[model samples]
Target: MEFYAGSRDACYEAKSAGLPKASGGCLLANASLREGQLLVGGHPFVIGKKDSGNRSSRDYYSHKLAWVSEKFVVLWDEKDKRGWLVNGASALLHIVMTSLEQLSPAFKSICLFDPASIQEGKHPHQPDSATEVLLNINNRQLRIYREDDGPPRFQGQVEICYNMLEKMIEYQLIVLERVRNSRIIVPRAHLEGWDFRHLAQRFDPIYPRLAVLDTNGKSWVDFTRSIHAVTLFGRGFGEIIRPTGACSAWATLPCGKYYLAACAADLQKIMDGHGGQYSTPLRLTDDDIWYIPDKSTGQCLCKDKTDATHSDLAQILLPSDMCKNLSLNPSGCYQTDRGAFIFGFNEIHQWFWNDTGNPFRKMAGESSDLLLNPGISYMSDSSVFRESLGIEEVRDASYLRLVPQQMSSDNYTVGIICALTIELKAVGALFDSTHAYVPSPDHDPNDYVFGSICGHNVVASCLPDGDYGTTSAALAAGHMCRSFNGVEFYLLVGVGGGAPHTNKQDIRLGDVVVSTPKGSKTGGIPYDTVKTLQGGVHIINGYLSPPPYRLRSVLRLLLKSDPNPPKAPLQPYLDQIAQSVDGCGYPGQENDQLFDSDYSHLAEAETCDSCDPQKCIQRTLRPSTQPRIHYGLIASGNQVMKDSKTRDRLGEEQDILCFEMEAAGIMNTVPALVIRGICDYSDSHKNKGWQKYAAATAAAFMKLLLSNVPVSNDRGQRQQAPMFSG
Candidate 1:
């Protein structure tokens, strides 16, 4: 730039300009194409027209000009295909028009720039220092984000990613989402180099605002092949930014070190392709914490890390020695007084302990420090991070997982609890990205899986195999509440018997039933526990709690979407489940046989094949196979209703539209809404054939419902990375 800055050809400089909007939306074309103008960094710039001498001068009107240190401006001349970058200094270096278009493709596609959109990005440590700049590109998006390199910088050069200005013209890359970590700060008294000062123009907490790319779209997956998709927090579960498939590989830090981390399944495949000879004899190819030993000597070897690997197995990783004082924390790593290190698996925090003993390994000294402890976390089953980081969990439940802490459990906001493997399958199939298992507390026996969908992080759990009924669901829900924090609400999703014999709903097999209050009774009614004296069931202490306002509000919007909302919105999701999980497809209505309430499924019949069709109840044919969603009171109990008479009697008594085994118990444990896909009429005719499709319908509805639910209660705000260098 210094070379070009000296040439000083017929380049342009701005003294002042005017706009009706009086904001920054101007493209510096020749007079013809220009229509409107905007202020840049809160000041208007004018391109002085040439006199007979071909020179330009400042034309100061009533508007005051900003200082040299106050603004950074871009003057785009679309007519001449030229643009300039000015730092409020007199010298204006022209930016090659090709570079700008390389990332955005067409200049015509740019939106009107608003001064409000330009944010002041400062160093996290030195808050007022403005030495680094970032250019973020999304699908059809060109935006800028700022990051202060903090303590990670080498000398004065920024450590945060900043190669965009250098490479945009030749090789353009698309960033998944804009970079942001906006937690407020108080400068650390002891830390030496990081004394942050508030800017002259303070920051808006919602910096780097962007429209997240559609999770179902393939554009990002294809784009990831060439460059990394850097999601700042809760990567896998948060849908933060996924480097997915075989192309999902990158150095997972901003310091520019090539520290390649991969899932257990992907480790070998990545190493095989990028293998290089190391300076040491050991190849070091596998991706797990291990120690190599001499075959003859049979002694522990290469012991320098993982102090609490046994008792702390997958919980935390403290640098081998822990009986010491501490230094600073970077990202999540801490150095102790003894020079041993303990790093958080991520950029946030977690607690640690002293021991885990195994017969195969030697004992290390007791970890003594109660100081700030860093730990490991996963966003999936066998794991759920403590919800204290930014991750919007969910994806197509694909297998691309993250081991490193891109998402903590706090990253997960919605909890889905299922009771069977088929039900779990349906829920898992809908995850935006399936997170690697993060071990949970021993008391939480429920297996958890984490993901992000629609704008919320989702954590799912299943009751142990062969477990059914209220008690089992209660235990699972209790465990989830204990381990997976930050969940705003829970959805008990799975299959249940449809009590369509009642006049309220024509719920057929595979239709979805959402629990909504009816009359004076609430949504989920524990009919089995209710007092049934005087031939009418007495309220079982108000039956159940009303659905949470967040859920109720979303439901109202869903119902009001249309008098007859087409199945179009949910088709894509249903098709996804059908394709991923076999038998989840609509199991033709021909197999949907509803027998007379008095007629029992023949004791010898496996399906309805041998049963008398003449005795079957005739019902109106549905217009299509699309699952209809019905919202009303649901009858919940401890026992499965295999008798149709009991089911109808309960429905009529309780004003129920559906019958399920788990909801009563779950509602008692965790305040939630019960959604059941009608697998069969609660009768002897109930079979496993409709379970999968039924579960799919319920899960699809859950996804659709969430699509309308806002990421409530600041849950979407990611926890900021540590700005202090300890």
Candidate 2:
């Protein structure tokens, strides 16, 4: 075992023998020599001063000598002639020695009286002067140390030992400094005259605090106060700068050399080899060691060398642990060392490093002269950069489409079908707002208008101009269903011929008629069906389904209520239609005269103006002038019911309240309520004057009915009918 002893007598002996005097008037034994019996008496030895030309060497040697002499001490008893004290003044020496002994078996077996194996060098007292001692401590083979006697020898074993010992002392100082001021000094070394312009260009955006220093310790460029000082040392040289908070140091090789040393170019080469982009930032820790091939043709980046493509280049080793407490991140930074020259794959922040100063302020200052000129004031109003970066291309108009397919199904639940344009206009005016139109692939040219009415999204559509009858209505309903997913219920709102029966009901002109179930038929009855033999009896073919029971219950409740809430007035909607379209004005109650079912009018007359009033059949006087809302089955067919005889026959057989051309067609596709305003008595004396007024009354009643119906949350899905049995 090796031991060290120091005393006041030893300090005098060391000075007389040309040895260095350590702190506290003591002399230090050669710790590396492992002397068995160390005497406390003084011996002459000289501690040489470090060269002033190398500041790093001076600091390293000075600090390391002071620490080793003060921390560890061994003493001998001359009278007993045996080694007694280990660290004579320190109370913690036993604990430190016990921990050391537990760490290594070699330490446990070491004897302080005899350390001949450790001190085998020829110059035992002057261990630093012996080249063999330095080589042994540095783990170099004894044969190589004996053979190499050139200047390279000075740069090898001795330099390695100095660096190691210097690092140990520096670590202790770093811990002490960190406690005093939360900062540490990092050592760095780099190549001579290396160009850092490329590295600065890429890394400045990510690491704004980066600064480069030249070999003379002068900064390469002026930097702001916010920038951190990054010292760059020349090859094989290092220095301890003032403690800066969280700082890093980088080492580089000499100029024109690529793989001889670790530098920025080596990191760049790794990035370029891997497609110049990373999926994640690469992190390099201080303790990591990376090895690069000395020659350019070597397989430095390849994971394996099974193809016999290995190069004869010597390996360049980078021991990053020499610079302690560093975490290097290669994100947007171009010059970063990643172990084994492998680039990570990650997103990079390009402008994260150098964003300290305001670039706009510099630009404004440069153009101050132009701004001062009165005639050049317009230049400040115009921005060339803004205009260049603005959107410039106009989108194609052909891409725009306005159709029902673009409407959202979730927004609408009620679909309104109008047989005439006037009918569509009346209902459309009740809508709050129209939605954006979307085009459908189907060739149906029906115009669809979307709006909300009574808290429900209502889509009103009209049959193409000149199109009439149940078949056309069926096609329009199918197209609407495909475009809007499917509607909850359809409101067939328009004018229809009144089927007034003497014993059944007192239906009159300009009154609204809501379709309801009667006996076997529900909602609207298709009167055009041809009777066929079924079980030896005539049966109605292609029977239409009834309107949803929920809607029917609401209608029944409204009809049974006293005074029917006075019917929501339709005059406002009628006036809106009149202002927008001519001839859609109210045709007046006088024009709404209901002729007897047996009366027949002149064939060529457009209105009752030229017709003889004496020829028109008169009706029984009604009690009130106000329009009434009637609920009964409405007869729908393909043909217009202009003949009084056919209308009466169908009315008596099916108990129909009104006759309309489109209801049968729509009822086949969507379950709906057919609301009609009686315009004529289903007789030959039919006039076109009362059609608009009748259409308006029907639309108004529809708005009232919708107000009473609850809004449903049934998107496009089918809903079960509410039970009406109770």
Candidate 3:
């Protein structure tokens, strides 16, 4: 056991004067030695001050115990001296006393104390210190005591008392300053040249805050990375800067060399574009440690400097104009008029007359400016970047596509600018600049029109003969074509008649008479009877055609704009037919009934050009302008009637309005709706007036129908794109 007691500010002691060297000793290793702690042989002692600079050395107190072997120390209780002295093997008092006589004079003075004195209960008389007392041993115990406890009284034998008393006196003498041996500071006189006092003023006049320090730690004012044996109070020599008006000096840790001891926050300000000479500190790229200059220059003078890398910015275009005037092979490099350049490839060469001829490659042997080859690069002729430069290489620049200035007004001013990729398939053969073709109606086994249905396209074909048969055949063909093409509607256009009718009739021969859902029995439609029934049959009494709901709105607007709707002239021949058909006598009682109807007068005579008695004739053809229109139903049959009896019977049986030869053949495949300008009664009294005027009426009516039919695109919600139903 070992113990400690009294105030921490105390002297230390040792024992064992003039004795044989002993093997063991004990100490209060945790706490610095304090006064009144019992030493070997019952002597009291005190520990010394740490101010002597010996606090850091392991051997500072070791010299006092030189007589003992390094490994052995006896533990004893400072206050309760009755406890056993712990040695490796028990020895007699005589042996221990003799061993103490062999110790060195210095070693004889050091004391062995109890560690338990440190545990003395807190008392008013004793001032407390933070140091702890540790007794190092195997199973060793410590004891603590107050000064009033008096020196420890040993419970063991009093034999060899004089020798023990002698050892105790020597133990008390062992107390010495704690900092007796160290090496980190210089005497005050040695720091005279350091100028630490005038650090603020002696610094460079312009670089006011800059001060120099000897990086080597050879003087009191100097510093090193660590403390040496000479350190002040056993610590390193560090700089202490005490600013004016400050009670305490601020300390900075010693570094390998001089270091700026400024606030890291202030250092950051210098690096952030502040107006200071050392605005930015040089940094070691790998580690973030900054090298602040000793002098106030912005540059760093450290041997381990750093390294780094950098980047830039740029625009693009071409060299010259190459439109129409370009030759096959030109001499020299055919530069763009602008001279800004890039190498050209076959892809670019192919596009020489592309979107807006931007000559890319020029051939050799032709004039460089006038002609171009197939492999040179040139400027684009488009004015997209016109403000930059002008291109003039003697080529027809006008050939470059010129967009109308009005495009901006309609918001379509933008054009595509594409870079060359690979060649496109040769598709120009199907188009003549204006129209782009897909598959043809003839070659296409599907029987589809070239363009129809979806409404985005148009289909155009010609009729060799312009008559009801040809026209009706075309209409039938068109309807069939539309169905095959997935077209949503049909348009029948060309010419037709304007006729007089009995319902206050006053229609001109040439003026258009558009069909309005009119058809008579033998067959009839919902659209026919609902609004068109009059005098026992469906008939058109006016010129306006029935427009599909969607197109009707816009067509109405167009019609409203026409100021002379009623004054438009009628065809001369249609007038003659109307007059003739009105006078023609009917056959039998059926004839009387026909004359009794309002549309009987409207019926014009059908005229046969060749007067062939074998073929049936058309009464009249309807007129229209828009191609999507169709005339109301006309009769189709095989009988050619020259007799009044047959004509009246035919009329009575079929309620047939106008007769024709081909429509029935067509109706088998197409949904037919015939619009006939009533031509004649088809009796024995057919006249020359019937032939001329009927033809005229047919032509006029055809024109009228065409004029009235709504354009397909304007028809009710357009049909969707066709999918392959098969």
Per-candidate TM vs. native? 0.47, 0.41, 0.23
Q: What do the candidate models score in CA lDDT, each in turn? A: 0.44, 0.43, 0.24
- The lDDT of model 1 is 0.44
Q: Tens digits of per-residue lDDT for model 1 on 324-349?
A: 32232222211111111111122122
Top candidate, metric lDDT: 1
> How accurate locally is residue 213 in candidate 2, as Cα lDDT from 0 to 100?
18
Off by over 4 Å in 3: 1-486, 492-514, 519-566, 569-633, 638-657, 661-726
Candidate ordering by TM-score (highest first): 1, 2, 3
lDDT of 2 by residue, 1-726 (tens): 111111101111110011111111001111111121111222212222321123344455334333332221111111111111121112121212222223234433432211122223453321121222323443222222233332133224233333332322232232223322421111111111111111111111110011111111111111100011121111211111111121121111112112122223323433343223342222122222232212133222333435533222222222233223223333332334321121111012100011111001112123322211111011111133112212122223321121112356556788899888778766754443344444444555455666555446677777767889998999888878777764678889999999887336878787888888766778677777867775775645656778888788887766664231322244434433443334655555556565555666777887777667766556666555556778778878887778888778778877778988998888778878899988888887777777877887888678667756665554444322121110
Please rank every candidate by lDDT, starting with the best: 1, 2, 3
Best of the two (1, 3) by lDDT:
1
TM-score of 1: 0.47
Error of 3 at 34 (Å): 99
Listed per candidate, the RMSD to the true structure in angstroms reads 19.1, 37.8, 47.2
